[model samples]
Target: MKLLHTSLAALALAGFAGAALAQDPTEIRIQWYSDGIEGEVMQDLLDRFEEENPDIDVVLDNVAYQVIQEQLPIQLASGRGPDIARVTNLKEQAQHWLDLRPYLSDEQVAYWEENFGNRFDWMREDGSDAIPGFLTQLTMVGGFANATLFEQAGVEMPGDGATWDEWVEAAAQVMESQGTAAAFAIDRSGHRISGPNASFGANYIAEDGSPAPIDDGTMEFVTKLVNWTNEGLQLPDVWVSAAGTTYRSGADDFINAQIPLLYSGSWQVANLSTTIGDAFDWVAIGSPCGPAGCSGLAGGAALVAIEYTEHPEEVARVMDWLASEKIVREFSERTLFLPAHAGIVEEGGLEFQSDDPNVPPALDRFVQASGETLPLADQLPAWRWANAYYGALVTRISQAMAGEITLDQARELMDQDIADVVANANQ
Candidate 1:
């Protein structure tokens, strides 16, 4: 009887151990770009995900922002891609991503479509079929103007519904009247031009999904830029400076009453606030409209799951949670980004306070502009190549502005640069 009892006890212990092993998840890996505060926020969110799903163990691999775009493809090809990754452009990674259409419920897809504009093109690559990943944020570009400078000049504030031409006239007037301050300033680098290039209706590649760089609108844009510069408007050298250099010098110029208007994205709001700290009032307005009403470039990071992952369902769950309204608000609030999710912005009730009295009107201008602008295409090759082309174009424009080249010469150079980029992207 004692031997039988011992045998039963040993068998029960073995069964319990097997059950525990079964409950443990086959490990999952996630990749993300990390910066100081955003990284910390992501880490906190990941911890929460792990806590809720005890069975799954998550391994996070943080890579530099620039490296991820080039490295992700190689890693995916090697069969060593993380179970999840934060992707920016879906068109680039569409071939590698598992089509999420099969995984998401019909109801979920409907909900996404209603709130987030159109999810069909955003989720699919090649514009046919295959949902690559979900969009978690809405990136926007607007005009950041130093309201204090305008007040000092005693210029009538720009109206919320002002057109691009009206804005240019106002800026030129300010520069002429105010000797020490520039009327308008922008980073001529690829990063800054993305928004304006889109506004100008320059498509680096053709709409038929082919590599075609020639566009008349592009030349018109160059002409407009040159004309603006010649109209007593200051085009600061700092606008064309290299990437990764802090915009602090330029922002400082604005705060110190040197530059009145700076064109940049919503992400700069926090940096501007911290750097200027209410010394003077500053406000952001939406990018002015072109022939096609206001069209601003939309860019932000997104989360994607790896094709090789054993737990695609589990990874999708985490992604869904991250894209939830609560998470969007948390991320946007912490990073000072315009919320990607539609309702969350209203729910979060984000408000900006400026020391300058003119800031309120400027904010209204931005809000109106944002409401009318359209998002840029998320196609990877086109987006990336356009950025390169725009950078070169800006440099050429800057040279023309400084009398180093004629407007015609700048246009020809830009045309050649665009042609080269489109060819390389096709190859």
Candidate 2:
């Protein structure tokens, strides 16, 4: 009888241990890219999430934007992907990720659709049963102008609905009159050109997941760009030589009153306000358009769940929280990006600018651009290949602009390079 009692006691102890093990908190790994401030904001939000759900542990794996593109696929294949990741384009998520449709319910879908419009379709795959992730912010339209330079030249600011031709002429007049300022400046590389390219209806790819050869629109775009550079409309060495001058330099040029206009994303608003606060008044203007009216490519990032995560539900919960109004508002206020949530923009009292008086008008121009038809780039199978293409295209165009090659030669080279990429990708 004593032996029997001992055995029963041991069994009870074993059962208790098993239950304790089952109740252990789940750990979720999250990966994201940061531009300094946004990283800190995300970390703070994650800390809040951890506090609210003590049963879950969140591990952040911060990576550079370029590095994340190269590392994610290999990590996923090796069974070491994060539970949640921030992806930039839909094609990457659709090709390599698990469909998130099962995780989002019909009610949640309806809520998102009703609030954000149909823009979320960019995150969906054509035939896949998944809704990959949610967009938290948008890069709105706004160009920086050198008010000091314009004032000195006695040139009136370009109108809100100015066409590209009008803008070029105005820029020339400004440069000729001011003598100190460059006519216009831009980062003619990577997605930096997406805004102007989209405005001109020149896209790198087609909608049906196929490569679209550069059409007449592309030729017109190149011609205009080359002509602009040759006509002394661009700063010397702006596109010809590889310098350390980035889009930020272009902004600085405007602030220091060296360049009359700098085309950049709306994310620069806060940084510009802080950097050049009251030094010389600056204004934000809408980007001039092609014959197709004003338009610009949508630029931002989205949060996606990996297919191999152990805690899919927890991942979804975090995404839901990030997409929530409170967190999004906080992020927008901190980062100066336009909130992805329509409700937040309407009711959140997000004052986009306190320093520059032109910010409100510039944001309104971005809204107008958003309303126009814009083409979305087809997703590349591997992000490395996409980056390679971008780099090569930029170099080729820069060379052409410098009179090293003709536009036809550049187009032919682009076609061959694209073909090689497609072949290698298929292999």
- Residue ranges of candidate 1 with Cα displaced over 4 Å: 2-15, 18-27, 34-36, 59-63, 73-80, 105-117, 163-181, 189-216, 227-235, 239-258, 289-292, 308-310, 342-367, 374-405, 425-427
TM-score of each: 0.76, 0.81
Residue by residue across 304-398, what tens digits does model 2's lDDT show?
A: 77778877777777766677777778887776667777787667577653556655655656655556535443233222344444555666677
Q: Which candidate leads in TM-score?
A: 2
What's the residue-level lDDT of 37 in candidate 1? 49
Error of 2 at 130 (Å): 1.1
202: Cα error in model 1, Å: 5.0
Error of 2 at 400 (Å): 0.4
Worst 10 residues of 1 by lDDT: 240-249
Worst 10 residues of 2 by lDDT: 376-385
What is candidate 1's local distance difference test score? 0.63
The prediction achieving the highest lDDT against the true structure is 2
Candidate 1 residue-wise lDDT, 1-427, digit = tens: 9999999999999999989977867577778775324667777887898888877777777887766767887888787788888776555565567655567688765545455535435534544565455555555567777677678777866765566677777776667777755677665545455555556676666566553553566666567766776764646545433332233235556656677787766556656765677677778867766664565565666667677877777766766677776776677666555555667655546543334444445434544555665444334223435455655666677777777788778767767776676677679
